[model samples]
Target: MELNHMTEKSLIRYDVKETTKEKVIWTLVESLYEQGYITSKDEYFETVLAREKVSATGMEAGLAIPHGKSSAVKKAGFAVARLSNPIDDWESIDPNNKVELVFLLAIPEGEAGSTHLNLLAELSTRLMDKEYYSRLMAAENSEQFIAALDQVSVKEKEDKDTYEKTILAVTACAAGIAHTYMAAEALEQAGKEKGIRVLTEKQGANGLEDEHTATMIQEADAVIFATDISPKGKERFQGLPYIQVRVAEPLGKGDELIDRVLNNPDGIVSAENDTESARGSENQPANKKTGVLAEMGQAILTGISYMIPVIVAAGLMMGIAKLGAVPFGLVNEINDISYATHDNELFVILHHLDKFGFMIFQFMYPIFAAFTAYALADRVGIVSGFIGGLFAAGIHYRFWGIEEGIPSGFFGALILGLSAGYIARFLNQKIKLNKNFQAMKPMLIIPAISVLSIFLLNFYIVDPVFGGLNVLLRNTIEASQESGEIVLSTIIAAATAFDLGGPINKAAGAIAIGLAADEIFPLTARVLAIVIPPIGLGLATVLDKYVVGRRVFDANLRVTGNTSILLGFIAISEGAIPFMLRNPIITIPINIIGAILGAVTAVLLGAVQWLPLPAFWGWPLVENIWAYLIGLLVGTLFIALANIFIRHMLIKRGRMTITS
Candidate 1:
């Protein structure tokens, strides 16, 4: 379908009275449903809300495009709504700027790859034009709005001239959505005005689009790479002269960048040059160092992002394996299934699956450390970081006749990764090697020094200290469990739920998983604690709607909350993050309190989980399953009541204004 055919007068609503983003989205979705564009309103709306949770669709210039490709959509269509007042904190690229113009897209699941993407590309291009945006904003009615959209000219590809100085550019950002495309457009527009042929590849959410061929790269005089991330397939431009800058640079100063390449050829940095120096150049703005730090942080996040899939997949597999082993009486006790050959077929299969899960978990530390270091010092830091992680996880040291192997877990891996990365960076920056021996810096010199230094530091200093702390922590938790001290359990539970999968929560989880591995099954309080916060918060969202006599939770958020409960059932605590982000003041405390109560109650009832995984599916494996259920139910109710009370207080104090 054409872009013009996607939009219609019936789909455009000017001067909408909706005060909230949820209300605005639902209004447009309802319009689409009424016009027979969607097969089911609820299904389409839920899909859109799920997409929003991944990342906000709000772009710059007071515009938001919230689209979803779902089975509920009958055909591809677009609905535009101009809000009377902009929605605050609508997760825009610029957080301070609210969204006024919203284009809600509905496309059938089958059409997502072909027609949906084409319409999105066309719409995104039109929205980027200032005149088109201005025309849409000024339109008083649906007819005028349609007319304004009709005036937008579809962008046509510029023919390449071999005689002209042609440049190929790649643009990308962390999200790879708005900034990536905008930079591409700016560069293309700037190239057109300057009589230079510019070919841009946008690496975005939908993956690479309009990719430049090898012939195009070889033909170009210079390459410009504007990206927050390291450009994918960077080696393809190895011999070319290139200028690298932040993705935002091309969006505003594309013309200036093109002139720099055309006027001063030497100004272009070679792709072979040190990428770190190119990205964190001293000649750039004052925030260059800050940008460097942000990049480092992004690297750590990238490692965690990769690690999460392994955790989820392996954790769930182990959980399922344990369920299958129930009838065979395998996994009835801690470490009941031996690694040796088993006689029973079902038991053997489940045992191997459990072993497989553990095998995957074993790589978690090394992967985290490697990627963290990779982010800081690129390829040079990988070996050193991996070594550092191994040292953190398994190094044994003797100090004053006392011998102990440090089990630093995730936190230790994090520190080691950072240390290895920075050490590699320092060696790269400070050590002045001759031009002839520069290759040795990465191959031999850097890795050798980094690995040796990290190993020594972790063994002599870091390990002993953290290892001793680890022992003390485990002993304390064991002692608490022995004494049936609910207070200690409460504290652990509270800490686990406080940040909802942050450092504190992960620390508690790591300790529990470690203890479980060692056959210390009494620490099921931590396992129970992990599932409480998300389930409780989700329950609160449902209860708030029915108990408060008003819709305190937004429609999108309500759907997200239900998803959180489902995730909670599978022992994923991060599902509560969206709710926590919305109202941390109330949500966090309630979550902590609920988790504490649940854990304490479970402890008092002698609930025990032999396996490390926490989920309702794994409930049958736990001792006193009924008591665990009771604790969960009670905690959920407490969290729900707490949420209702807080909202009522906020409304009474005029802090929150409820429309319904």
Candidate 2:
């Protein structure tokens, strides 16, 4: 499809009166539907809204781009609304933006997505210029605006001289979204002006995109890699003359980058399966990150991404296994399913399935730490990360002569992952060898040094700090039990909600179970604490937009939050572990506060739970079920509200960025 033809007079609206974000979006989507660009308005509308909820599409100034990628889109097209009045409440990267124009794109589900992204990239490139932006905003009618957009779409690349040389480019970002393609477009456009054919391979969230075939690589004169993450199949570019730059660099310095590659010849990369050469700019160092906090957050987020599939699989399996009890009217927890293994065939099948879920659950820390380290130090960090994670999970602590060891939890994993990543990265840079022996660096030297460092750190540093804290918290829980029901409930609830399934949580459970077994303290507070965080965080995901006037969690998180709500009913607090791991500073305190509030409320209202059952099936066994429900509601609301407001403040202050 022609780029200019994507939008015509029919798809463009001028001086629209829609003042609300929803109304503007609906009006634009309806136009696309009427023009035969989409199959169904409802389907496309929901998809667009779903994308919006993931993260707002608002750019800088007065522009927003809300889009939907679905099979419901008949054609890759867009509907533009140049609003008569600004939409004040529209969520944007620039929080103070008064949105006056919106480009609502309907993207088809498959290969057409590349073309769709290219169009947006071109638009972004054009709008980046102040004069071009002003001219578009000053356009009196849709015709003028369409003409302005068409100038770049149809003529920008096609205007270049006939090509004699060929170049290949790879572009990527940390989020793997718009910037990846935008940089690709910039390089391609720059190469066009230089009379060179630039074929861009986008290594992004969509996976390896574009065809950089064997024939194409053989014929290429040079390669340009503008990436925040590692490009896939980079081995294919071995011995190729390549220039590496930050993902955002080519967007503005494309012409200069193209000139550098064409003029210079020392930048050969991947001879020893390493991409590093003398970097293009000494000012912009290789693997330079935004900041300490942002880099750490990005690594944790990468770990979380790898861990999500593990979580979803385990959550579903365990949740289904729990539901197996409903038909039998059993009053048993997840662990007791094995006790009934011989009693019934159905119970036997569920017992193994539940065990399988637990088995998969155990890999979370290792996978998380491995990927987190991978993000920072590449493959060299994997060994140290895995070993560190074992310590974090308390799997190998028995080697220290402790039979019952405390798991160091997510914080431990984070510290170790960072330590390993930086250590590996530092060593990789510092350790030098000749060309013949350099291959051993990634395989032998780095791994040996990294693992030894990790062992020393885990043994001397990580375990003692986290393990000691857990022991102290456990003692505190036991001491508080003699004070009063309120005091005991608060302590039990706080500890249980502290780390979800970590050492402190286990410690709280141990003391609480001992007290309950002796009939000294009922199991009311401990049971309530188990499900409160997951359910509360889930509720917060749904209610955050309404509370703070914008979405705090991204799309992936929203899905996790929904699953967490389902898992919470079956008494799985691990569903909310991602939230705590993602933002412990905010999520932990709120979790403790919420759990304490709920536990105290339930105790004060006479909700006594003496039985060991804590899942949904156990509610009937409680002494005052209504009080339990009321307490749950109060705590959930407090958690939801507190997280929303606090996170909103953090986002506004630029302390956090909600990635798509």
Candidate 3:
């Protein structure tokens, strides 16, 4: 099918009056349904909503592409709408940017991965052209709209003289959805305007499209690597001179990057050198004025980013499995229960599912290590770091005089993973191989050498040193608990709530989970700490409106509050991060204080959680459910009152404003 075949005049709507997102979506979907492109409007609409929930399709420009592929779609097509008024909260990268132009796509399930992607890609790239976007916005009628869209093309103005100075670019982002294509389009457009030929490969959500060939890479004068994450097949550009920047950089400064490559060709760094420089920066001492600590902080954040999903998924699965097994009496409490003891089919299934979830949890440390290494030293670090993490997590080597496995946990994983990554990076730099053997260096040589080295180091050096340190730390905490249980609980709770999901919070959580894994049930204060912040902020939202005698919060804040409360009940502390970020001075102190109070109260009341999981749904698993509830209630009230007081003070001092 032609790329522009879906852009029919019949699908175009000018000066639309729809205000809300739902109305806008319905109006566009109705147009497609009327035109027979869709068989079931409701099904198509629901599919589009589901897509929205994944990530907003809104572009950096004032355009939103809400699309779906479903069996309800009879044909692959698009409906265009130019709204009379912009829609707020459309999930644009720029929070202030609103959606004025909408492209609603309906694709048959069979065509979604093929023709649909091509058409979507074409539209996304075309939308980046300033002239094209302006024409679409100015078009007065359906014919004009179709004309403007038909004018959209990927080819830029040709200049044969500058063909030899051709630039090849690859664009990618973590999501690999909008920014990837947007960057590609921007570079293409900028190259055209600057009289330079540009070929772009977009490594996007739909997978690599319009990939540059080896011949094209060799012919190119310069290369651009615009990606947040490390690009796939980065070795392809190893010898090439390139400029690397964040994927979002090209959106506004594509022309500048292109000009820089053209004007100062010598300034372009080789891909290998760029990688080494990045590694060097990461390895810089924390005491250095340069933000080496920030780089380390980023690596830790990357590890946490990968770890959270595993924990959430496993926690939910185990919780649901426990809920199912509760009725069967196969699992009465959260203490370690063996599925082997259960004989009933239903109970066995539930028990095994929970066990399967824990099995997934086993990879958490390995994944954390691998990605952390990957963040530091690219792909080579991944294999080495993973092996290092496996060793950290109770992997025994008897021949090396290690009869007993040391449970190093997340802390040990962090140290070993970082070491493995640096060692792999160092090896890559020090060991030089011919071009023919370079391929084996990454695949065979790096992994074999780095893994062995990390294993030996971890087993002989790190295991004994850090392992003993880990034991000492745990013993110190245990000692504090014995002398002053409430004090220790309060401190742990405060640290967990201090940063929401940041390093401090993760540190506290790791300690709690580590203790729980060691069969210390009552010491799991991290569970209450995780749930308290979100619940407290959510309660504060409601109290601000009722007790404060006015709606002190905005509509968005109220909606966020509702979502936070729901997620908080399920033990998702990250849900409260947005609120904390908005008013850190007030929110942080209130959250920390409230969490400490709740944790202390829970510990004092003999509330104990055997499992590492924390959620209201797991209340039945708590040794004292009443105490758990009481702790939560007390914390929520304390946070609510404190928040109200702070906001009232700020308002009285003329530093804050009431929304309504």
Candidate 4:
């Protein structure tokens, strides 16, 4: 079999008249079908529309390339349409006077794999030049536009054959959007101008999106790291020739990226042209702190990884165990699950297993949190801080007026671990010993100082913090009680929904976990609030498939939303991020409303339970099991019903389509 390669001259078109987005799309599809570029206009358009439903292909600027690959394509081809006017396609970019150019792309199903990605990358590279794109928009005739495109297409292929030296680059952003991709393209363009090869990767909220082979990265002569966000793939880039830049700086002065990469030290910690050059004096500062943070982060990840499976298994098992322990004839509640029912031997056995499971669950969070800190700071932090957390847990269990027992006391563990890590680092930096005794600092002096500091802090500082937090928790519950339970639920629910498992969501989650530990919130309430976000958002996305777009719905969002619920059971908050990011306008506010309604209403109604697990653990032990069930059911209904309404409007307005 053979293939026909598309050239620049074959891709140019000038007179496109459809002014609206849907009409423009249909017109283009019809044009391609008429030109014998596609097998069926209806089939190809349906495929493209389905993909678009998942996410827009409008990669900023005045450009949108709505495309799909299927067996229906007669040949690999592109239809460029310079839209007479900008059209609204529910894109992320500005709608006013924007997106004047639309590129309709198609390729046969067999050719849609790597070749499609290469073409997309090629198109993206050309779009990176604002000046060049502006010129393309200004072209008065088809011939002029073809000439400009020919230049780009010819220049790209010629550079491919030349011997190119590989350079490593990293692009990151605080938001992990907008500037990350832009910076990557800018650096690649700059390297090409200097006749250098480049392989760049990005780290974002989605974690590492691109993973380059170890061999390719190792082969690079120099590296450029442009970032505001934390770069996680550092271990892989170790000992490489590297220069670091902020993401924005590269985009603003892209031409300088190659120069900076070429001039950087072959193998170094800090860049050669550092602004703090004066600090590199003859008597270089001793006790240089390098890799400490990286090491700590690794430890934390390890602890969390080990703890997650424990939490899920124990929490779920305990929830079912609690059900068996429920007393049928008692007016007063029994703290012990085995005491809740004395008649049924089966219930008694499950209750006993629940006790054991609860104990295991208790250690999951704190142990992992302490370990995480240990990984960051080393043995000094692991020993001292984890001990402090245990002390905090003990204090909570004995004196903080906890009724349900502080099984895990996660907050205590977290504080203890952090304190130990920092105290050790501080002592290591400050204490000066004889040169002969310096070797013992990390093993002896550092640990000794850290443990002492942690012990004292736990007895005095952490205990006081715990006292204050306990009072605050009591006061918050009482105040919400006075104001109606809905208020409390609303606040927590809003936090959970705001960022879709980000900082705000985590804040709400930590609160729920803390309450569950104290037996203030029923095991069921916490589960309902936690689980509803992902389940509701996931449902909303499914119902409003058309408006939400098909590509996103099919490719990335479904997995993200569905998997988030699974993660939620392990107390991870970020699982609902895909739907939130994809349909922020509709999903964000609705999610907040639903969560709050569930939380506040359940609280106001006096839905309380004493369970050994968090709502994040899902089902089973929800506080006032009925309240949890009702809240989740209601929230799901609200989101689904609302999405249906929104979907109808979108379809009626032609924002969503059923036809090609």
Full-model lDDT for every candidate: 0.69, 0.78, 0.70, 0.56
Deviating ranges (above 4 Å) for candidate 4 = 1-119, 125-166, 171-189, 192-221, 227-229, 239-241, 246-255, 262-311, 319-360, 367-459, 468-660
Model 3 agreement with the true structure over 131-184: per-residue lDDT tens digits: 778888888988877777767545545655765578888897544545678889
lDDT-based ranking = 2, 3, 1, 4
Candidate 3 lowest-lDDT run of ten: 281-290
TM-score of 1: 0.67
Those runs of model 3 whose alpha carbons end farther than 4 Å from true positions after fitting are 1-167, 172-197, 203-209, 213-222, 226-232, 236-291, 332-343, 397-406, 456-595, 602-628, 635-660
Number of the top TM-score candidate: 2
Candidate 2 displacement at residue 659 in angstroms: 1.4
Q: Higher lDDT: candidate 1 or 2?
A: 2
lDDT of 2 at 20: 88
The TM-score measured for candidate 4 stands at: 0.46
**lDDT (tens digit, per residue) of candidate 4 on 7-28:** 3444455667777666767877
- RMSD, every candidate, angstroms: 8.2, 6.6, 11.2, 11.9
Deviation of model 3 at 272, angstroms: 8.5
TM-score of 2: 0.79
Query: Candidate 3 at residue 36, lDDT?
Result: 91
TM-score per model over all chains? 0.67, 0.79, 0.54, 0.46
Candidate 1 lDDT score relative to the true structure: 0.69
TM-score for candidate 3, residues paired by index: 0.54
